[model samples]
Target chain A: MKNNIVEKIWQQHVVHRQAGFPDVLRIDFALLHEVTSAQAFAMIERKNLSVQNPEHFLATIDHSIPTRKNRHEIYDKTAKNQIELLRKNCQNHGIPLCDLDSSHQGIVHVVGPELGITQPGMTLVCGDSHTATHGAFGSLAFGIGTSTLAHVFAAGAILMKQPKVMRVHFNGQLPANTYAKDMIMYLIAQIGIGGATGHVIEYTGEAVTALSMEQRMTLCNMSIECGAIAGLVAPDETTFAYIKDRPYAPKGQQWETAKSYWQSLSSDAGCRYDQTIELDITDLQPQVSWGTNPEQSIAINQVIPFSNKTKESLDYVKLKSAQSIAGLTIDWAFVGSCTNGRIEDLRVVADILAGHKIAKQVTMYIVPGSEQVMHQAQKEGLDTIFTEAGAEFRMPGCSMCLGMNDDKVPPGSRCISSTNRNFIGRQGTGSITHLASPATVAFSALAGFITSSYAEQQPQKEAS
Target chain B: MNTAIKQIKGLCAPMMIDDIDTDIIIPAQYLTQTSKDGYGQYAFSRLKQADADFVLNQQKYQTAKILIAGDNFGCGSSREHAVWAIQELGFQAIIAPSFADIFSNNARKNGLVLIDQPLEICELLAAAAQQNDLIISIDLVNAVFKTDQQTFPFVINPFFQHCITEGQDELDYLCSHLSEIKAHHQNAKGQTIFLAGAGVAQ
Candidate 1:
């Protein structure tokens, strides 16, 4: 059989061949972070085994380090210890680390592409689920467990089964108010969370091609939400241009060599997929998750699906059937995360909230994915708009996206979040979350309900 | 790399928390594509109001390998990072009443054992892990977990269990059949060639 992209990559990196249903593939890159690496490094010490491939391994500290200040001692002691442990582990093993103060230091997913460390046609492994984010560059990246982390440390390889491939083709132009975040959410809602189970989806179609590199990353970033192992876009000029000047990207003559190789990473024209899902971007609108799962979503102007009409698969979301979501009250509004916390997303939110103030009942928070993004937003005075609009501009970190760090919605509160996943207590214990794009989140914050910026902006258009 | 199988042993603290989604397990904000470096540092870093109060923050539990969690542990989005973070944080097996269906499957696929035990047993194991040296023995060959206080039998879908016991991976398993896979292709190629020749003759 002609090798697919996945098979070709697998063959290139094969260190050992064995017969069986479950195959252990050696890994090429092993990414680490402070939160999960501390224990793995300690385990290595306990085992007295040195990392087998320090060159292929990389580390960065992002999770616990407060994005608010770059000061070294500002983080809580435990956060400090975690960072310290990662530093010690990387130093001892001779593995390079991007400490918080480094320009390269940021959200692991964002830093990888920004530095050009996440290249196309490579297999990448990290302890973060958003590792799928790298698939935007056509790399086969996924997350692994700490034990697997140790195994990779000791052996520079992991055992993985080849998953079936699913092709999601986006055929038309996305509307103005629609973004990649909305596009993916619409697909998830249609296919259900487990629709892509055991499959790696390859996104195609004109709309996907038209997306900016950052937007493409956002599309791939949430593939995990729909139970996909990874999501990838075929490499093109857009991909090459984005990586051309990245710090770790090949330079000079090697740049040409790398570009040529990336160009060839696309699937053969007739390559067959196990499943195919086609979507029309023109028909899609800004989407938001009204229930717990990413799949339980609808357009902003729509009502919550009535439970009686929902498939059995959607019962877990606990959403009331037939409830109009347009005016649903909210307690919090969050705009950040690796998924939608980039500068572009912030720009969109700022545009929507420019002269408006957040409703009194709504407590809005904006977290940039990286310090770089934070600084860029501040430079553009977006931070002022957020604060003046009654939104708190907090330091960079995962924050309320997860109940981690200092930001969390109190239990029983309803929040409209720009982050992916509205799973039960995703924001906090007993907190209800609705996932929306940054623009929709901003609009909702101002209205104190789940509404659309398009509708709010309608009045301005009429006035003009 | 050593091919010899190494035995892993130590106290197991199964988290009592149930349905520990990926976000909570390793929040979404931390899911950046930076080198997988330093991720262990932020594992569960957000759970603590004061970082010191986090469950994994205590020095005594730092090295614990056995995690006892509640039902549907590792539920929500399927980011392998939850497994990576858990594994990177030194956990070998997660003993729970149950697991998020997908996470349990992925954990096994990635070589992290998910031990599903009775709720009572899981709670007891978690308590022991919190208080004293709660050493839990994981016999991959037997596919069983034994603690001084109790013996629990867990199921590893046969295919995955075989991979762990033999220290093999899924890719290795698939590659072993490369010759057979290649032969199948060769036969198909031969048939195509023969058909082309026959058509020309006709």
Candidate 2:
């Protein structure tokens, strides 16, 4: 039987399989964060199960950690307790931890690739859903709940029923000013939130191939947003080049052997998928969410229409159909998350704000995904650009993504954010969030409303 | 880890809204609570707040141990709290037209039975849930739910069905194959960075 890249990786990792039962798959790496790991650790303790392969796992304090100016104190009692529990749990289990002060500290997904802990042809599991971001390296990565995390902790494996393979081919060049974030948002809007519910989506074609590894990670990061178990791009020269010289990646002769192995991991010729979808993006536009969900997106140039679900979302968001979001004004513009907080996202925001100033009416927050990202931005003067432009350059953490920490969108205030997921009150109690690419968020920050980068990027001659 | 879910018989409430995401099942605000104990009161709290007479809050359906929901139920986020909330609210099983993959997996691992029925049957059940005299009885061994006037069968993954009936957690079963797991690692080539070739472990 011919297998796609997903099946190939699945077959390589499946330790045992039986008819009508889920395959027992080995986990190459298991990641944990402060928010979800405590319960799993408690469960492991209750069962008296020691961490089976402690070396194979890594823990980080990301969610529920404050990004505020206070260097150390976590004001929220719940956040402080969760972080403390994670530290205690990691110490008890002898697992490596990237605490808040560590150089490796960052969002779990960001730190994984940065430390070279993520690699091709491996099965990665994390308690957080954005673990799919690792699939950019041609790995099978998906989120597991606390119970499943404990299962992996005890056995270093997980039981999984194989998902059907679906290939989404983006077969054209994107117009200027569009980014990978737009590509994913557009795809999600085309296929409703439940479109890829049971399929492992493999994104292919010219548009997907043109995206850098960091951009590809952004694409995979939102796979869960649109209901995919995992999304991946086949490893190629870009993938190999990106992995080279990373901290945890194999070096020297090991690198050569790994490169050869990765080269052979693509889909076989004439591979058949359970389903294939071809999207032509020759005229794709920068996408922005107008309603309450990630799938409730429209082109920045398009009007918010009263679709079947729009009335309910609009009522919550306090928006009316036909009202242009461009000059609607916003209270917040956040630029970070597991989805778009990578250095590349930071550089885009910096590049946009180089000579410009953030609108006085809007309060923009620029957060790097990891400690490395922070240092890199400082070295590159991106932090200076943002700070001088009136945006607050904050510490590395999952800031305002789900509003677990000190940074939160005030109630009833509208925000244009680069983070994925615009679920009702996700950013805070009674807060309204609109999702967009980092470029769009940056541009909107300057406009003090939800505006598209395309208008900003129009040729000066044409604009004049 | 209490996986025993042999038979469940009780009144069920119908939430006919499509794409009922996990956030609505239990909001993100309630997730940070240290204990999983009080999630029951917050289950469908959004709907209860939105519509005062929501089915889950109704006096008759307050103790519903089964839920008949719309298509594509449990469709957002990988939060296991969705399952805990539903389970804490005394729902033993959820019968739906379909379920999101991760949510369904979480439900099974936590011993909450997920029954997949066709859209027509689900709609029928949803209507049946509105009938005050109707009681829903789920027979997992046979994979069917019985009402006074009708019998609708559902398809459950065989292994999940076995686990539900036998009260076996998947982790316990997987860990029992410790020898096999160790041998798998031992048989692999040195440097387990990536499982390189196509050969199965001896």
Candidate 3:
């Protein structure tokens, strides 16, 4: 029987299935991070269950660790304990640890693909919503709760209801300065935050295919923002090229076999999907969020519309409706997260700020997603240009993304961020967040306000 | 995790807001604690602050075991903390117009019953917030909720329904099928393993 790639993957991983019940699906890999794993590890100990597949388990410290200039030691007791718990748990269970100083350490999602640990046709679960980033490789990856994490630790599988498949075809060319971030931000606006509920989206068409692997990751990483279980792009030559010669990827002749299998992992022609959406990105402009939720976004030059939630969102964000989002003053500009902290995102910002200095009033931060990305940016001297332009080049972690650590957007401040999720008080209590692409964030930092890279040029002055 | 929830009859603590994300249920700051206990105090902390008269904070709704929420309840974040918080705060079940995918899954794993009803019904139930003598009864076995006026039918994934009624954890059920799972794993391994070939692109 012919089926789409999602159905084929489901069939490959089903260990047990009964009518009206979720299929017991086998997991190929389990990724763990600091904040969400401690309780799961403790549960495992209480139940006396060893990690069944130690080799398949990978642990890292990201969420709780301070991204400041410290060699070691977390000041916050809660964060310190969580990190310590993760290290202890990984050591006790013989699981591989991507410790703080490990070159491979970074956000779990970022490090996974860069190290070739994330591959096509595999089922991966992390205790994070952004785990959908792995779906960019044509794999079935999504976040699981701590209870499911403990279950996976004990049995290497999870029971899941098969999600209905939705295919979103992004037709036509994406205009300049509009990136994967814009494409997805625009998509979420088209469909409200709950539009894709109970479905897995397979992004297709010319615009999707044109995005680089890193860009594709950015696209899929925000699938959770739209309430989708996962977002996937079928593996192609570009996917294979990105996987080649990575640290954990199969090597030599095994590579050929693997590539052949990956090539076969696309949707068969004439296969049916539960829903199909046609989106034209040719006329798409750079998107920017005006309100609290991601769906409240509009094109950069547009004004905030009075939607059902607009009044409440405006009261929370302290922005007036019908006012142009452009030229709205911002206190800070952040360029990082599992969303847009890749090396490519850094390079774009660096290229923009190479000669121009940031506005004196705006405090800008360029946080790389992973240690490898940080190192790569430094090797390319992108760090020098950023620092010379007066932007802070911080270490890798989920800093300021949720402000779990010391890095936080001050209360009553407005920040233009490249991170996903602009929910009310997401960055900090009483902090308003405006979500945008890296290009827009960089330009906003340069202008000290919410502006676009494609806006008309004005006389610029160097920072005092 | 094994507590059976075949039925829950109590006053409904109505959170009428739509898209009550996990972040609002329990903020990120409180998630750092390794222990799942003590989360009840933080349940809906932000929302409670926003609206001081939030039903969860009202003394009248303190012991409520059922929650009536608006559309897309438990939206945002894959954290089980939201479910843990709700469970700790004394909610045995949540009735909503809809729920986010991950949050709904987390609720099932934790054996917290989540019933999805039509939006109109949810709104009707939510309208009875903080009012005395508005007891609601949920019958998990029949997948129906009963009020003084009417009974509304809802849907639950049969597997979760079985677990809830049997007082069984999902892991326990999965463990019962261990041998079958192991055999399937062996078969999958045998089929997918490929030998490293001669010198290929390095």
For every model shown, what is its TM-score relative to the native structure?
A: 0.74, 0.95, 0.96
Q: For candidate 3, write residues A24-48 as lDDT tens digits.
A: 8888888899888888888878877
Kindly indicate the candidate among 2 and 3 with the higher TM-score: 3
Give lDDT tens digits, candidate 2, residues A1-464: 77899989888778999999899888878988877777788777888888876777888888777787674797777677777878888889988888877888989999988877788888899987778899999999999888899888888888998889899999889788898899899889988888898999999998888899999999999998778999999999898888777777777788888878887789998999999988888998888898878888888878787666568789898877876556557789999999999999999998998888887878899989999999999999998899999999999988888887768899889899999989877898778999999999998888776777523432112111
Given candidate 1, what's the lDDT at residue A226? 74
Q: Which pairs clash inside model 3?
A: none
Stretches of model 1 off by over 4 angstroms after superposition: A1-3, A70-77, A308-319, A454-464, B1-73, B77-102, B105-159, B163-202
After superposing candidate 3 on the true structure, give the runs of residues whose Cα lies further than 4 Å from its correct spot: A454-464, B190-202
Query: CA lDDT of each candidate?
Result: 0.72, 0.83, 0.85
> Given the true complex, what DockQ would model 2 score?
0.35
Tens-digit per-residue lDDT, A1-464, candidate 1:
56556655665555444555345565656677776566567656766767864766778766666645544664466666667778888889988887766665667787677667778777788876678888888888876656567767765666566678899999889998889999999998888766776788899999999998889999998887777878888889888898776566666766776777777768887877888999887878889887766778999778776665344224433345665667777889999887888889899999999898988989988988776788889999999998888888876666677665557788778899988878766776667888988888988899887777634532111111
| RMSD to the hidden true structure, all candidates | 10.9, 4.2, 3.2
List ranges where model 2 is wrong by over 4 Å.
A454-464, B1-3, B131-133, B189-202
